[model samples]
Target: MTPLPVRIAGTGVHLPPDVVTNRRLAETLDTSDEWIVNRTGIRERRWLAPDLATSDMCVAAAHPALAAAGCAVRDVDAIVVATYTYDQPLPSTALIVKEALGAFRALTFDITQAACANGVQALFLGSLLVRTGAARRVLVIAADSASRVTDPEDRTTRVFFGDAAGAAVLTGATTPGTGLLGWDFGAELSYDVEIPAGGSRQPAGATTFADRRHYLKMNGRTVWDTATRCLPDSVLNATAKAGLTVDDVAHFFLHQANLNIVRAAMDKLGVPRDRAPITVDRLGNTGSAGVFTVLHKGFSEGTVRPGDAFVVSAIGAGFQWGTLCFRA
Candidate 1:
């Protein structure tokens, strides 16, 4: 039997009220707002309060998403929380969110390692659960507390990330030829972006703490090269897989990693600049939440119309990248 198409029933987002502007960052760092903006195009980003964790963001995001979907907590059959900056490793962040949301009947999942691409992966899993009849409604939350992982004084990594969470409710699309239609997911192993310690390979200890090994490390140049190439290609591949062309896609929701990267990908695709919605300038790089932020914006503001085709894509620390083409 042909599987049903997964529809994004509703979406919501939670950005901490605490805003960190580039000028504020310059108050402590050696760099200025001009330099940061010229390079990253990030003028400001939200920071979770010192007291909160990743799960807090997830739970906050889930409320409105479930409400928007008209789904009760008990009706959510599965909860997928995607974040590398989990509250901790032992109890599982998904379970924490599920418990907080009072979703006792939901099966919880954590996509803890995908970094920025975690949102795409979570949405993929949500689609599968609905398409396979394993779930009627799935709540997928992508969030990250990047401030907790970056060195407080490192200008390189600290300036580029923010804390945020975005939630989506997924179900089978009753309309034929709508919902998740085609996808292209691919990865190439690379450690150019990683946290050097805090796993079984190197347990958390005084030495790792002193060296800041738990903090995320990234090669900006490598990220630039890889994202510029892989993202556009993946979009083309996925669009083609759906038997559509670039022109057929009404909106492009690429990972909100960098404004320049987003522009470059669109340039490579020969797509116009306005076709993609961007939230990185105000939100910075919210890791897994980036895609959701943009998606929520497009959706809430009525940009994503019915019968229109759209493409969502991203890349992560595992060098994993994917594109999902959908009709709504």
Candidate 2:
């Protein structure tokens, strides 16, 4: 009566056709392409088209995953999408994706608004469903269009976000330690000092518009300090829980939020720089899609192998941070 293992059967991604390059943005902001590239390692990123939304990208990405898994959407028992930027206000993107994928039997829901950490969070949650025998298979999708939240006038924020979606199918198996080994989550809610004019507390209005409340605002320095301090420990803790050391992990799939942040965490964790798989140079930060986007890149390039150990981690909105250790 032992529990089953959760195995990732497939991975897929969808990036909008539009490419927003740093050079293109440099034409608007006071920043230079070199600065953005040196700091973030992002030369260009995908942006959702005017007609597309998070659900659209998720649905598109899900199709390939469903195909790879060799199952119809109806075979999934659950759907989970991790994103704060949904196409609509109600009904959840999970349901949107469910209908989009023609999923009929799955229970659907969304997860934390923890910006970049979401992809891994969604994956970890989906694993629980299969591991507990509550689900035969689950669809975990993370998609976001941060272009709307970014303030075009703010050089720092403007160059950091883009749009993309990634999907994974987790199926139940009789194998041991094949999927998620362990995960750890941490939060610093006091840093909830977000732009106060967008939500119910201060609904968007003329006054809010005047204050530019719809844009994403953050205590960037503070978050940087916290991430530099918190992220490594989260990785270490999760690795320890998984009964592995930093050296034991073959590839690191840290959040692709920024080049500096990833380097800092690898330095702090004492993991070699080359150990991490990265894609920010071309994808920017896809919010919750960051981890899987990198995962997809690695998979597409045939670099990831079966039995390879990996460390996936992130820190973002809500000042949340966490990590998951898994085997490919």
Candidate 3:
């Protein structure tokens, strides 16, 4: 299949006001700031208020992205929302965001279950729609309210997650070979990280809720092993497929899963750490919003420029990992 040329015109992010610091968690859990920082490299994270939902962040993020791209709500051809903790099960999260943004004319797509890698999945769809001429302007949003699902009392899971949303506007690139390029995606079935209930396999019920079955469960060591190994391998494979190497790329937007994981990928690739920016230190692991936040930072800071080669990569729950290469 022939690929279409699509470029990211703009990027944006929305972080809730409430900051959950390691010290704050230490208040409730038997952990210390130094311990959290040394292990996860996360000092603080954002948590959405009880009144707000993931869609609210998506709407907030969409406005800046649309403005940055010089496009309006009515002009957007599609809206792709990637999330796991949707507001509810009945109504689609994408539809909720579209209504809020007043982007009624756009088609909506919901990409749930990819967790941290949802952003890459949404990007693939956004690029496809633009390349096929099915949409001139595509709004891609990645958001997750891990605050809504994780066991709050469990320090192991709660300390590593935060709530936030990130968005990007994709449009056809005028320059040839300056859009979506090579990619690599792989997955292995594993319950290393997962939400155990609320689905058909374990239906939501009084027993499920009472037993605390409807919550996020994770195997931290398994996640660390899978991520450290796959993130770099995926990036290398994707870059090589694009006829480029880590040295040839100017910037790398990697999943904000862990600061150490990012460093490991850079070390494995033998590239300077500055080539990949860090946000996990401040925002923690924002699930699907992780990679997009890095992308937003790079674009807003003017770190990514025309003719620059860049790559976005992520590993999510379900042991899924992927990388997308682009020529900026």
What clash pairs does model 2 have?
none
- Clash total of candidate 2: 0
Tens-place lDDT digits, model 3, residues 15-133: 99999999999998989999999999999999999999999999999999999999989999999999999999969999999899899899999999888899999999899899888
Give the alpha carbon lDDT tens digit for every residue of 246-303 in model 1.
9999999999999999999999999998999999999999999999998899888999
Candidate 2 or 1, higher TM-score: 1
Q: What is the TM-score of each candidate against the true structure?
A: 0.98, 0.95, 0.98
Clashes of each: 1, 0, 0
User: lDDT for each of the candidates?
Assistant: 0.92, 0.83, 0.92
Q: What ranges in model 3 sit over 4 Å off?
A: 1-3
Alpha-carbon shift of residue 270 in model 3 (angstroms): 1.1
Q: List the lowest-lDDT window of 10 residues for candidate 3.
A: 1-10
C-alpha-based local distance difference test score of model 1: 0.92
